[model samples]
Target: MDLKKILWDFFFLLFETGSHSAGSLLRQSPQPRHTLHAGPRLSASASSKELLMKLRRNTGYSFVNCKKALETCGGDLKQAEIWLHKQAQKEGWSKAAKLQGRKTKEGLIGLLQEGNTTVLVEVNCETDFVSRNLKFQQLVQQVALGTMMYCQSLKDQLSTYSKGFLNSSELSGLPAGPDRDGSLKDQLALAIGKLGENMTLKRAAWVKVPSGFYVGSYVHGAMQSPSLHNLVLGKYGALVICETSEQKTNLEDIGRRLGQHVVGMAPLSVGSLDDEPGGEAETKMLSQPYLLDPSITLGQYVQPQGVSVVDFVRFECGEGEEAAETE
Candidate 1:
């Protein structure tokens, strides 16, 4: 039987059987929807959105045309895009003008606390492209979360012996530059350079208390792709950390509750910036609480903008971080 006649017969069956028509067609052979195009496949399956971006960037066409082409070709990107261009001229539809530029800075600021340990870290990249890369973004999150679990109270309050230092592989040898041979900071900087974009530690915080129910944490957007995280992407993400009794709430429950609390009340410092946000950025950011609240004075929270605020590290991205330029 000719392929054309077979298709005609299938369509007739489709009309006769309605929903069952597709099922019958599927039972006979590979479903058309699941079939791949006759060309090289992407490294990973490109999302509909990603494909749309490729079309716009490569062809400088509109989103609508790209979408229509993709659908009309049964997900054949090449054919759909080609059809879009031709249709553009035939229909007098102006080429979808390239969307205006916005430095869609993408990355994430992760916050986590278990027991008395808590930390916040900013992992950023120049363009959304690198930021959205899964490996890059996940590295940032895991590091941030790990730092909170292990480093929070490890090194605070130096005695006559060792300086107030934290534990964890991270502080294994500090005063050792960003890398040791390189620190996480140094490693992050190198990654930014390698990717040809600026990346830096905007800020970080760690907290541990001797007693009391230590606050726990909750992630705002758990289902979001790590690659697509937007740290300075605007008020893009939220982290909720709250102080509660371990006795009253289970550890897992505490994290969820605190996260819920955070969704509502934007607590500053989780307690007090006076001893909260550690690291240089935190010290600088502490001023706002002083500036806004009359209860505290400059003698308390205020610190020289240039001074290091390492003590108050994970307090969310420091209010205003100076940008680094790459040569």
Candidate 2:
């Protein structure tokens, strides 16, 4: 045999005898070569676990992202994080909008009441900033008013739009402006598409009330900015609905008390599923923290409470499902 060939064979034999080696050399030689993809070159010496940890620390992004960046960067941790950031700026954000789903614990609610006919709507967004946007607030306002008029299942409702959103497609019924047209649904999608992330409608509710005495709205945690139009529904709405009835005068006082109760209580279902004929005030006896969540109970209180809450609805925006609908 030639000297080079002999030496190569001998080295393989020597390598195979080593205790601390993986059989990687033999594996590489046996695999087909054309399967390689054309992408940025990555240094093969980097450890994936260490590189993943580095990318995660550098970017407050997802763990999947760090892994993907490493794969794209050929296991080079540094280049991978940079490339991942760039990728987020490009096509990855919409998919990588995992951050958008965090607690919206902040949002705007819309309530519409005309005469005795009353409606309450809650629209949730991912952050307080977007929740306070002019267009978004307008959309929620229009939606609440729309629900007042078009109380139908959302399955067939056309998407909605404001005066200046990006929707130039004929598919959306909007008129063509420099940046507008399409169905209302298209318009909402346009918002998500333009925002480079996820945008949602949380939940929507429609309520109607007759002769009770109180019908006012209050929004908590809403910014005082004129640009933001978030109005909180529910507690304020429940109070309004409760007051509009022609119940006893004591009932109206009880209604106000219930409003205060709702603001503080945040009961889950309007009442307990076990609430039966003898149901006293479900919130009467509880201490302070019971009403802070939908779960748990304040039970009942005595003092011969005179008012009874009629029907009420609670919809926690984005709490139970994914986006309201898929397009």
Candidate 3:
């Protein structure tokens, strides 16, 4: 309390009194009725919700992740999308590493045929629910297609190769992604991130038909995809290579039935029907009875139809120990 302090305090006191009087008069005169006003906070909230929905639909990310991205980017759609992709990829890699050891015992077998070559891929997930997801199915189809292209590039060398087996590591470098701009592994990581589940490209195999032979395939329990018509997805699938004297068009029915027979009968080899009457015949494709008309053996069914089952491969989801035993 100096004299200067006292003077300053008095000056502020006088100013406060004048402002109070003005406010009182202003309040008394503010009586406007039926005035319309837009709430800024409500508008902002609605916009945020719309933005979140758009981000979710465009990115196929979780709502929680979408909202967080929007908030982190301050409601910017493009920036949020970039942030989500980066974050999701990072998270996906982390999740995939952590879940790598988990047994992926459920999934689908995807089959795709291009001309005389056909590829079958098995993609495994943790649960059936995740396996049935459209994204997961799309992943399988993409992997199959990518593997087909990879094999096609080796067409010249494949002439001598009976069949080619592709492990995950081999396919990891193949091109994938929505725009075919990323590696297969990156696409897989993204899927794992979005689905929040352990997924693996367990195994893929491709068979190329030799000259004078035709290939036919069937997929049991298949569900048609909205986008891909050439690809078939199901729990069980098979491809049969037949050397037929009949026209390719005429062999279509027998070829498809042979495929079904291989899948349904689970033959170990295309043993000659005359190998013996015992184990060889029992486990031979030709010796097995036709599924459509069980009264006749497959050899008799196709022999009269001018079809000879040259070779076949079958795939079943989660076959595990039973599959090994059969092999």
Candidate 4:
């Protein structure tokens, strides 16, 4: 055998004999040591636990629920939220269903206007506290903005530019979601699950005026300042579209005043008592005394200004419930 082979054989023989020299050499060489105590593994585990805690805080779900949701979604935050919402709906639906009969007398009216187009939305919650929540306000704003933009885009395709109401089915068809991958209904469901309360997009309306007309909006009980043409009314809101015969007139100012009038008067229509639809006592907008004067009728107040009311929408929180109870 070669010298190297002989050396290797001698080394093994010494190792088998438990020679001190061979054992010392073997000890000198690096060998991986197995440890029962965790070091890096513990750190990794701690990071995961921290992440789980963070998700629980954000979602308002319990630790075990959050952990299970994260695991089910492969640690994806967005998917985990979706999963949690699904679970909430499955588990909480029976309880939530019982709440359907409960009156949602608290809510905020969100208004958005872009050019001659304006959108109004009423989102109702079970309590006033939820109405004041920033998240709920944001949801209202998003829904109003989305509705305004969507309606404006559809102006040419649809014959009428005004829709007085949007049912749940219609709302479900509107574009919504973080990626616009879903509808407003989906977002509402997610919010309902997260908030642990009953919520509804009670109503929505959109109005688009012609070039000679202008749309303005007013919000009462606003928690924040208005942005652009949008208004975040804390509880009540109004939208008014005014048409001017002369292009030189300041239509924006007139529209704003009209909107304020609508908000104050809670007008139902723009015509006189003769023109009233004769359904509800409060539906006669033109017959209502002028909010500013309280002497002249609203129709008379506007007739002298060379401006005509094109459309108007007034939304008061819990108004529907009041109407329902009366009926």
Candidate 5:
């Protein structure tokens, strides 16, 4: 049918339906009450406000982006959320690529212990401010947990006396997220997008406590994680492996104190007083003065209690390769 005829017929049918007579239409004002636009203006309608707020609350996205997603998905909240995640992932990778070469000298050291094995991970970013962010902290914690799981998966290939280290490239491919179904690189990319910083998973270390020994851990400048359990974030962290002749003693407490000493004193190697001579002993874990009791060397303090230090791992944020060699 012709356009004009179709419009006329539509109007005729409307009049015939008797909402308003043709004479009544003529009696209406000459101009329309609402101004007409060439196209629909993007807006949050009253009916969609509830949906918009729900989407914002659930996704933690900005109001403007949530509104756009809702509009793009025709106000279907589920579809809108999925759309937002996809867009964020897409934008995250793009941002990560652009910022890949920027220096990341500030971040957190994450510590996690599972059974006899302990894991420490250093995840770096562009600034200390991002280090304190909850999302960034969560990412670091998840990476540490993933590092533990990754090391555990390789247990059969390693010896009891062995220590495992995973560099940046190897860490990027591991599983991350709460369920650990997502790639670590993708998780990091999402964080880089949201936090607007270049980040890298610099390194991870795994150590297993041998039979009759325990691993003790501590974090300097430590704070309890807001989301994850048994995970701590800090500027410096340490894990100490200890062997004790007295099995009835409080070994955990001793191990923790040793860890604190390691974090605070920054020991270079796990040397005994017999092995390190003169000034060299100052940098050895056992020969140095214990941080909590400076009058006593760590060896002097623990030996009477039948505890002997075996091995340790210490991580400081933004430390160079020279410092990493101590691990």
Candidate 6:
């Protein structure tokens, strides 16, 4: 009745039957390969290669550059990314400087508006073919929208518009989110590298209206269907600001009409010969014959409407560059 004796007798009976052997059972039994630490160490070279690939994918840098960055950072992914960015900044600025004096006669004007705030941006590339590129167009939109968003968030900084709305340095600092590697300048650099040509954020303007004022805009020669969202991807556009005594339901219509008129006439300013400062009589918006009704002057046409034109900005692509070249 003892347990050990009972098991021994049962095994002895099985061996006698000869259905299985102890040697065969021992051969089939599992055994430990080795100690955990005795296993192979991960390949450092493979890990470094993986980090290199990740850097290339995320930063859009050349494979050679990514590998060099990994090596420089001792295969640390985060440090490699930072090093790559520093290199990008250095290389981007160098590339920009080299292309600065090159004539950029072909590009698009991007515009965006939210509530009382609006922005206009001119982004230039070396060729018209590049201008039509979807990536380039998206860059223009991103820069415009990012700038508008930044300006709206910081009202006190809005005063900087007195000099100019944005400069290259300010644009380079804009937060462009993760897709653009955290800044507009980086996005631009990526574009330049991919397109193998020059790109410039030539100029930008921001307009914000006070209560009782309305801003309307129009675009001409858009590469795509002209809509409020993509209006800025056009050859020419105008932003017109109008002042009204009280908010009227018709103010938007009036502003839009004025915008269209400005786009057609390419007006220098909003006043007649008497009000304009030392300029040709025909250069003023109000002095020109109305676009809708050529028989009447613009001033005469708008006078009966009881609304006043406060300001206007008309942008024709390459106009400034043309003027500069002429001068």
Best by lDDT: 5
Q: On residues 168-282, what C-alpha lDDT tens digit does candidate 6 reach at each position?
A: 6777688874345578887787677566678877667777876766777877775542323544578777777776777778776777778788878777667643453322346
Residue-wise lDDT of candidate 2 within 53-85, one digit each (tens)?
A: 778877656789788888888887768866865
lDDT of 1 at 305: 21
Q: How far is candidate 5 from the true structure (C-alpha RMSD, Å)?
A: 8.6
lDDT of 4 by residue, 1-327 (tens): 699999999999878788877687787744434244566788879987987988887777789899999889988888897788678656555455656777777988877766766777778888998877766776687678668767767736433335456754676567773444466766676566656678777777777766666666777776662333345565777777666768745666766677778777666556643553332255567667667776666777777788767667677877853211100
Candidate 4: stretches off by over 4 Å: 1-39, 53-64, 74-78, 153-163, 172-181, 225-231, 246-250, 272-288, 295-306, 321-327
Error of 3 at 305 (Å): 1.3
Worst 10 residues of 3 by lDDT: 318-327
- Model 2 scores a TM of 0.41
**Model 2: residue 118 alpha-carbon error in angstroms:** 2.5
lDDT of 5 by residue, 1-327 (tens): 699999999998987777666567778874655335322332435457889889999877899999999989988998998888778888889999999889999999888877777888999999988898988987898898788777777645433445667889888999884564478887888788789999999999888755667778998888887776778888898888777645745777887898998888888888875753324347887888778888778887777777777788888898884335553
Candidates ranked by TM-score: 5, 3, 4, 6, 2, 1
Better of 2 and 4 by lDDT: 4
RMSD to the true structure for each prediction, in A, is 17.2, 16.9, 6.7, 10.8, 8.6, 12.1
Q: Estimate each model's TM-score.
A: 0.37, 0.41, 0.77, 0.69, 0.78, 0.64
Q: In model 1, which range of ten residues has the least summed lDDT?
A: 93-102
Candidate that scores best on TM-score:
5
Global fold similarity of model 6 (TM-score): 0.64
Scored by Cα lDDT, where does model 4 land?
A: 0.69
| lDDT by residue (tens digit), candidate 1, 1-327 | 699999999999878788687778768866555456522254335666787788777655567767778778877777876676455434321211121132324566565445445555555555657766654565465455445534643556622111122332333222322212324544443344334455544444454545432344445443343542322222123432233333443555534443443333343443334444333233333332343343553224323221212222222222345321111
| Native-structure RMSD, model 3 | 6.7
Candidate 3, residue 182: the lDDT equals: 73
The candidate with the higher TM-score, 1 or 3, is 3
Q: Is candidate 2 or candidate 5 better by TM-score?
A: 5
